[model samples]
Target: MKATHQPPTHAPVTTADLLRMAALYLRQHGWTQGTYYATTTPTNYPTPPACAAGAIGIACAGHTVEHFTQLDPDTLADYLATLAAFVDHLDTAYPMFLIDDDGFALDEHTSPYSWNDDPARTAEQVITALEAAADESDQLHLTGGQN
Candidate 1:
């Protein structure tokens, strides 16, 4: 007899849920994704180089399982499962930015110039990028309301 796999108790993961879960995980584990470390000293605030030359921002870090969240219930079990799968396959949940730490000050793979000038892309464009990333990874099973 074949053993049937049991479905996850947590709900599906969504874009909004992803952010929330990430924040929650960060808070719970005291894990900083270089998010707290702004780009600039005074926070360039809509200007170029939000942080220092090698500061951590939102473009150089890799995503993890804790980045995922459930829809109905805000539990982290679902997200953890996703992360587990990602690790098993040696796949990154998503490409993210982080602080290098050993460099100047929280240094990581940051853009040479400031990314402020670049106007924010439309929601559709952002969604498209996410979908593409998920497709490439082959583990991102996005639901309808996941956006």
Candidate 2:
């Protein structure tokens, strides 16, 4: 009798799944990122990257590190608004990034791919990506201000 070999099972995450995971991670970090985001249509002007790829990041603007300690509600709100726009801009840009740059594809036979070298990007990393996207958007320039 001949011996049979069984292939290993592999599961790759989808773009939608990654987006959902990113939203959950952001919420866990206390930035208040919403579960759903709207996409800008036509033009497709700005393309952003997926959360898994660190393309659409999070950020807090007009709020300094000291503000958090002071507990300024107004400033916090402003920061949140900026962060939302930043994320939205990212949503707009992500598709573009996927189109312009080589797409991220995982082979079922190969090992799974990691978003960041750390495998899991920290909150700081998310903020950094958001800032980078904002810069690319050219809508707002993020200066190293804290939230």
Candidate 3:
């Protein structure tokens, strides 16, 4: 007998899920520096992979990393604005989580885009950062926030 695959139940897709998908995208497609993606479009998978922020943008595009596709501007903006995804961005409520290129919160506000493009940045570092953000989001959602 053959079995069919079932779809994921998370209909609305949370910030944590978006972050995790970004990490998965980096793991599977490799990583890039100096660009959100070599191609920078959800309609097409990036070549030579995507930067940390780029991965996040790709994640914002679809339900899954492998199937990421174009999302309307408003929808994409909504994903990018999620508190978890904002951890590394500037001037957000998460100033404490704003980190430098080294992924440390040195009281310096470095955007994820700039951090990902740093010459010294590694793919592992970027991927790990995304996963960490997801974990934090998970904890927040489980402990004190609405899903």
Candidate 4:
């Protein structure tokens, strides 16, 4: 026999869904890899010890189970923008994603997941990023449409 986690009821993930799930996971259960939390999982989809990338990926693609037969990707918000505007707006929300107190955020130069997995990384930081990404997504929508 094997222990398996259940796929959440939420489906057809939206940007808001991704943002909300990631932030909430960090806030409530938290990303266990970093911080002083004692929870870890040899299996997958451990909600009590959520991971930023795992949460985001699960919401985005259901990495652990079959949550959705179709991903609509548009239920989150009601706007769109150009790439230039997006970059500009991103700085407004998450300029800190690339910078730390001593400056230079990423030391490993791996991926955002690695950044999330850093033991020095705080749950608040991941939560902020998730919230900021949602904000940036909304900001992009102000452009009317992709440009």
C-alpha lDDT values of all predictions: 0.31, 0.36, 0.66, 0.51
Put down candidate 4 lDDT per residue, 1-147, tens digits, no spaces.
Answer: 346867668644346546666577667765666422324544443454555654554445434332223334542121121222223433554343545688766532234445567768787876777676767666554543562
lDDT of 2 by residue, 116-135 (tens): 32344464655455555444
Residue 92, candidate 3: C-alpha displacement in angstroms? 12
Give lDDT tens digits, candidate 3, residues 8-118: 676677788888888898899878888666655455533447777667777776432432236566765656565335564333332334557988786555466666676
RMSD of each: 13.4, 21.3, 8.4, 11.9
Model 1: per-residue lDDT, tens digit, 1-147? 337877679974443344333333333333212333333344433222221111111222222211223122433444334333322222243323444566443423222122211244232332333334334434344445342
Give the clashing residue pairs of candidate 2, or none: 46-93, 47-93, 47-94, 47-96, 48-93, 48-94, 49-94, 57-130
Best candidate (score: TM-score): 3
Q: Candidate 3 has what TM-score?
A: 0.63
RMSD of 3: 8.4
What is the TM-score of each predicted model, taking all chains together? 0.25, 0.26, 0.63, 0.49
